[model samples]
Target: IEKEGWSGEVSGRRKDGSPITILITASLVKDEKGEPICMMDSFVDITERKFMEDELRIKDNAIASSLNGIVIGDLEGNITYVNDAFMELWGGDDISEIVGKSAVTFAEDEDKGRSIINVLQNEGNWTGEITGIRRDGIPITVQLSAGMVYNEKKEPICMMCSLVDITKRKEAEEKLQRSHEELEIRVQDRTKELTKANIKLKKEIEDRKIAENTLLKKEKELELKSLNLEEANTALKVLLRQGEKDKTELENKVLQNIKELVLPCIEKLKIYRLDDKQQAYLDILESNLNNIISPFLQKLSSKYMDFTPTEIQVANFVREGKPTKEIAELLNISERGIEFHRNNIRMKLGLKNRKTNLRTYLLSLA
Candidate 1:
């Protein structure tokens, strides 16, 4: 028995036989002789208080455990609570460092923070992207969402806001937008080229139809003139021979002038000191001169339109019996690049996957 008094909380049963919590205070009431007569007791229900405490504890744990930054501020925009994520995001080492400060300290400016609070009060909820500052003075972009908290009586109390780091997401969106713009530009250019090609093709088709009709109209005339066609052919042959002779004479004179005038100038230009790039350009110019004089380039280029200038250079080096290392040094490319060009050239020349030597094939082209 407790002599002074006893006060504690204990589980009890209600009149309806359901469980309840009771806070009990008991003491002994004695006569003047100090002998106990009857015990006095008082009971009060504390179920609601226990329930509220449990709810508050759960809320605190949930807020503290959230992955995203969560902040709770007073009506005046002063911070009351901040979770670990919020502290880390603000470059704070402890909750005490963050709490009691204006929540807008991490925002872009005081005006921006005030605007957010104003919008939340008027609009009941607010969400937007804002530039936030860290305690170390670095800037970061965050998606912020805020809402007004209320009491059980539905009166506005404080503001609770959540922030998410969207820096990487924003970068990715920008990159994708740039790629989309580039693709759109390329598509527009290709469409214009296709439009021009379509117009030219339509013109060619119309010309072909007119030519066919003209041939039909001249068919009877041609038939009627067949008896004199042999004499006409003989005269056409004599005229063609005279034209060929004139053309040959002009070609020989031009070749002689180039050999006498252009060759000397080119040789003189080579006598000056030059860098590797300038020397390479000079070599290419000389190679082109040889190509113009020889029929090899015309024959090969006529067979395949897919050959690139570099591939042709590689092919020329291969034809001259230059090794891959020497060709790479001359062309200022890797040996692997030279080998790749050789393979591409061989594939274009229909010698891929065959035992035929690439150098021998290029020589045959020459």
Candidate 2:
């Protein structure tokens, strides 16, 4: 269609009686009454359209034509036009062979073909890759761009399209993309491996440095130890000689004291023999001395085991022969409060039962 009120594919018969596509234009001429009395129109032979289309065909006959595939259909989807490229790629020779048939017949898949048709119906245009059957009935991929041809009233009458056979290009792109992704994955794996190896190498270097420093320190320590050993040997001999003389002196002094001062004191105490009550006082004094030293001994034992300060305090009170209530009073707490603190201590030390003697446990430490 070329002009307002003009419509139709400007077509004519070729020498072999084949129809060729032409661009026709027509305009309506109205009289003074505004009635369409006469029509004015122009017809472009579009022999060029025919020639170019043939040229496409001729080219395809030679080295495979790289020109895109082409298919043309009326608004109704009837196959009104298709280029030589289409015929060569898809199975159609004469225009009349498919002219009145639905163009979708050539689609490799019916559903996909219907989808394209729906797109054309809804959007008045559709373009994308599609699979079509070749003249040999082989499936070929083509890129198609299509537009609906409209009349002056803007009503779609036909659809014109251009197509490109992109099979090789598409395949090449896919292969390239796959290769790129594979290379990327391999690079990532290689990078991870290298990173791990680098970390291992760094650790080994640190270890080597630590070992080298330790060896140097050991060598120095061995030299010092050798000198110390010699000094220790000489000191041992000297100390042994002094120890013998000191032993004799200490024996003489101890015997002299026992015979003089100790005997006189013992005789005096004997002369004023202690009553039972006085003897009881001496026993109580020894017991109090033991109680005072118990905490110091518990702390010393804690060097071999981890006893918290509260556990140590509880152990000390229990050793002082104080009942829980008295111990709680001395600590300014209730007996129940003391029991709660003791349970916490026992749990922390992994003790099983509340009856487990906390004092006995402390004494057994170390």
Candidate 3:
């Protein structure tokens, strides 16, 4: 062997042109002269082992950087290894403080620790939710998943466990459940209110229909009464017209009977001789008979509504062709009284201070 005898690890190339890793030992073969002749070197291939070592290193790094805690423990439940996440999860600052400790020391409950040991011993694996206590004595909830590490002979060696924190997730689920229940209660109350309102609305609609029907019936009755009143008014108008016609005919008949039947008898009485006073009486009777048939008296009385009965008599005598003296004597009044009545008649007839003859105006009325 040369100076150091053996080398630790060496890089080399194989005969197949592939890269390989090896461990080398070098020694010198000497002649009897005690001088170096040929150097002999032995190479041990470690390519497989190097590759396995690299893979293991990569896996170790991965475990250290994992978000979930990772742990390795022996069958006796003693901690053999732990990643950075595991140490941090248990509130530890260094791995040395946890490496030799019992794995069950992390469990918050005694029964949980016993159950975990029993599962590892009997079934060789365990996984479920568990409460874990930290170095600060604060408890946390985690989902633990563990499997048995086995040797080539299938014998159990150690236990590997992964822990995932689920405290926040559980709290969120409980809050959501409570909110769903409250929403359901509010919806039920709103539905009940709507049902009551719908019932009231239906009743109001029914009452409105009844009121409208009552109003319609009353309107029809009023319309029928209006029609009956219109018919009665028409019949009364016809009766009034007939009564006016009958009154006109009766007035004509009365005038005709006085002119034809009484006037001739009065004219024949003038032939008998009599005293002055007796003759005056007969003239007065004839004048009265002529006035009874004069139609102008009735017309003057109707035309001048304000004319007194005495004024009307004076007007009738004046219209019958009687002199003012005779009218005054017959009515037992003075001549000035007769003139006063005539002047009043002229004023009432709207002929005052005009040239129209009073006798002519009175006769024109006939």
Candidate 4:
């Protein structure tokens, strides 16, 4: 059975009995005849071609579904195809408006775009950041990586480009640059303040050094004056000791003169019989003579003491070996009052040490 100018695929077998797939083109072959005499068919094997077509469709679908914009351009840098992402990124709703344009037309910097194409043609690849303009005329920064697409023979056919929008990264970098400039300005201002503070600190240090030097000089002068004062005090102490010795000697001589020259005359007058009034006058003269030497005896009695009148009276009674009872009668007070005064005298004269007796301590002071 044969048909004229009608062909279709069908299951068949080769001479070797291996199954095969075929694409047949049907035609009529006759000698200059308009009517078909016999059917001539051309059989072509399409098994590998079908597999290649299916693979190409799968890859194309993947490219179309990608998030980053991707484009394919011919050898002349004219756009050949664009993914859905590319159209969306470029603000294009229709692919017809973008497919035939030069790939550089979307770049804000066309000069850099042309240079990138030139590099891709020579080196088979190019990748860099470039400014791209959307169809809406809004500009965006993008990272572009592109390489030549090859056919089955490894011949260069076109270039496929991948683009990622880096607009936020670029904007953040510019903001960081501005902040760095401000920080530099603040550092300069702080450095100036520190410089001024350093200058003031140097002045204060210089003033303190001068003050310390002056204080040291004054201290040396004070030490020299102290040495001179110490020597003067030593000489004054020696002179005071000599003067005390002379004073004691003068008192002894006066006492001796009075005892030797005047006392015998009073004794002789006492022996002579005299009226009561005259005897009273003679007694007063002898008593006044004894009063003249009393101060020197008082010095010996007190042992160079300067006690109050009551304390001196108490000390004299104790030294005279007067008991507490007799001393209290003489002082017109109780025995306890005499004991109290005796305790005070013992304390003021630094007595009562090692259980010393009040009478013995006062006698020793005398």
Best by lDDT: 1
Per-residue lDDT tens digits for candidate 2, residues 218-284, read 9999999999899898989999899869975875676566557655554465557689866555544
TM-scores, all candidates, are: 0.57, 0.42, 0.52, 0.49
Any idea how many clashes model 1 has?
Answer: 0
* All candidates in order of TM-score, best leading: 1, 3, 4, 2
State in Å the error of residue 93, model 2: 4.0
Best by TM-score: 1
Number of clashing residue pairs, candidate 2: 3
Per residue, candidate 1 scores C-alpha lDDT tens digits across 1-366 of 456789999987789998788899999988999999999999999988988888999999999999889999988789999899988888877788778988777787779888888888787788989988888898878899899999999898999999998878888999999999999999999999999999999999999999999998899788879867988989999998998799768766866777788878889999999999898889878877677456676567656769998997788788878899999988899999998999899889999899999888877876
- Candidate 4 structure quality by residue, lDDT tens digits, 68-184: 899999997999999888888888889999988998888898999899999988999998899999888999999999999898898999999999989999999999999999999
**Distance from true location, Cα of 268 in model 3, Å:** 86
How many steric overlaps are in each model, in order?
A: 0, 3, 1, 0
Q: Please provide, for model 3 over 215-276, each residue's C-alpha lDDT reduced to its tens digit, 9 standing for 90 to 100.
A: 89999998999899899989988997998799779878977887888778877878888899
Q: Return model 3's CA RMSD, one decimal.
A: 28.5
Model 1 residue 361 distance off true place after TM-score fit, in angstroms: 21
lDDT (CA) per prediction: 0.86, 0.71, 0.84, 0.82
Off by over 4 Å in 2: 1-66, 91-96, 222-366
Between candidates 1 and 4, which one is better according to lDDT? 1
The TM-score of predicted model 2 comes to 0.42
